[model samples]
Target: MGFKNFRFQVVLRVALLVVSIFLFFRLDFKSQYVGTQLALGILIAVQTVWLIVFIERTTERLIKFLNTIKYDDFSENFSSRGEGKIFDELYQRYNEVIRKFRDVRSEKEATAQYFQSVVQHIGIGIITFKKSGEVQLINNAAKRLIQVPSLSRVDHLSAEAPELAKQLLALPAGQSTVIKLWQGKERIPVALYVVDLVLRGEDFRLASIQNIQRELEEKEMEAWQNLIRVLTHEIMNSVTPISSLAGSVAADVQDYLEAQPGEQIVLQREETEDMCMALQTIEKRSQGLVRFVHDFRSMASVPTPKKQLFEVQEMFRQLQMLFQEELLQANILFLIDCRPEGLKVLADRQLLEQVMINLIRNAIHALADQPNKTLQLDAFSDPDSRVVIQVSDNGTGIAEEAQEQIFLPFYTTKATGSGIGLSLSKQIVRAHKGTLTVSSELGKGTAFTLRF
Candidate 1:
């Protein structure tokens, strides 16, 4: 029996003993002494034995009831048979407590099972971590996301789930970040979200991860669709005028040749010569249209790159030689800062050369109107272990609003510009697994940076 039950029994026995003593004295003084004394002693002994038995039964029953509760046998009931009012009341209260506990346990189990099912079946990955940065739980989706070997204790995820752990840790609390995980040098984009969870006065974090490859692919398709639309619009604009002019010239030449007679031979000869010249001009414009179509087709049919290692300095030298005459004629100063050993990069040499050429040509055109035109080409290594090539010019720079669309296909500020150069250059750079970025300030200068 517990100490409280034992103490309660002891106090009851002491109070009963004091009452029996007082009753014995009062009865002896009021009535015949011997029989009264014997009757009172018998009564006292009977009551003491009964109280001892009652206390033992009650304590044993309470212990059994508590054991039933501990063993999760809530069906077991405390019998109130042959018990006093206090014992009956205590049994009633105990049953109520056990019933409430069982109800709560049932609810908890149901909730836990529901959550488990959701986590296991959901498409997105879900991971929960303790406040100490240790992974506490990971769903099946999460295991597949991180490529976990097996479902085990999630503690110390840094070793078992390095990629996922890195992404989760990089995310700020209550915010989401997109990260590209490298699986054997192949980048896989994943969107990660982290949020704090507080439970029972302890703090934790939950991370949800989703693959964004399909979304990005869809966006890329949409962008390509827009590019095609723009190309069609530009080609039609150029071809429509050429076709109309050519048709008109052909008809005029036919009518003049048919209406002329053999009598005015001299006048007919001069008219025939003028018509011939006009027809030649029309032929020249037609040829220009054909060349523009060819260029457009080439841009549209950009081929897959064949990657190889190439020297950067040699590429720059080749481009400089190609544009040397234009630089001289435009009164532009061209400067190149090439590395001594020629920085080597793993890329498509031909594509890289094309990108550099386009960038240089664009810079030259930008500097065409400047009296003191200056162009600088610099190649260097960045702190992030990337090789960077920069082309800068001191000319009228692009406007801020137009800068965003400059790399877009068929977007240009110059009247004579075809606008496919920068877009094609960017595509080429991206195919080489590099980036082409531009920065410009109006009236100051423009810089195009390529990083590999």
Candidate 2:
């Protein structure tokens, strides 16, 4: 009811009660008059109570409505019946407000759940941390990459890889770095991309991490395999004719020597000796070419990779042993750098070894006659999460012009280079679905990287 109308009703009820009291007092104590006075007294009492209750009802209902909102008791709906029009309208308004609040809460919960699902299922590892290195949020990918069930602080990664931990703590916003970390027997390369964010006036760092070792290895092997097929085809055709030419030259020299009389041959001994030397050279060259072709053929015929997961550190150890004596005699420093120790690759161990051996041999040759020669073998994971094996040398570097064709069979800068070694190496890498790539500077050095 309107305030003015409610006030008018209160006055009317009070006046009626007052009139009843006056009538009860004025009536006589005779039997008929006593009954009529008693009825008036009872009516006054009831009317007085009704007036007070009516005055308090609006305030009482308002309090109850407030309490319902405070306690989120939307299920207890206000009744809109029985009460007058004014009270019924107020009750309906209260129910509508509660309904709106309930809907807002439900929508918020749904949104929170959706974001939580995305964070948990993303492929890239994501970690959010404060300036103090305390981790605020970590996703499933991050946990798998670090091989940890949970992360409380960035420092926790130090036990697995100190460099990785340092990178996580210190990496600048809008920058990225790649590092190698070993999880059990597998050494993985991880790329970290970091950015800074401020949420609710609190500073946080977000990092995205991914392992790219497998992709590098697969691509590197494919390129090498393609190059090997080309070498095998070209060499087979070239080697046959050279072998025939060598035989023909040898036969001609024999005939010339036999056609000359003994004394005449002796008189022309100098020319005969030159012919013999030339023939011998031809025979030697032909034999070497034949051997080169055979090697290339074998390399080209690489069988499907008998892939098995093996630790890269173990492979490095084997390479060190194989080259121990040779490197020592050459007075060269051979260094093996396998970070996080247990880096593993799924590949044919024997074939990969062969490919690496060829690369190391090339590095060794490049270092020959050079002062302060150093060769380094490094194994790690790249940003793409691929396993990378590198052979580097501080030796006479390859010329830029020769770098591109060096992997081709029969193409070499050295007088005695068979050229099949690099081509065959590439083939072996290809068989494993990896890549063999070289980077070199003429005066500085060369590095051959195998990604698998």
lDDT of each candidate versus the true structure = 0.75, 0.81
Write the residue-wise lDDT of candidate 1 on 59-82 in tens digits: 787787778778888787776663
lDDT of 2: 0.81
Candidate 2 residues lying further than 4 Å off, grouped into runs, are 1-87, 222-276, 287-452
Q: Count the backbone clashes (under 3 Å) in each candidate.
A: 0, 21
RMSD score of candidate 1 (Å): 13.1
What ranges in model 1 sit over 4 Å off?
A: 1-76, 151-163, 182-186, 259-452
Model 2, residue 201: C-alpha shift (Å): 2.9
Worst 10 contiguous positions by lDDT, candidate 2: 1-10
TM-score per model over all chains: 0.48, 0.50
Report the lDDT of model 2 for residue 376. Answer: 97
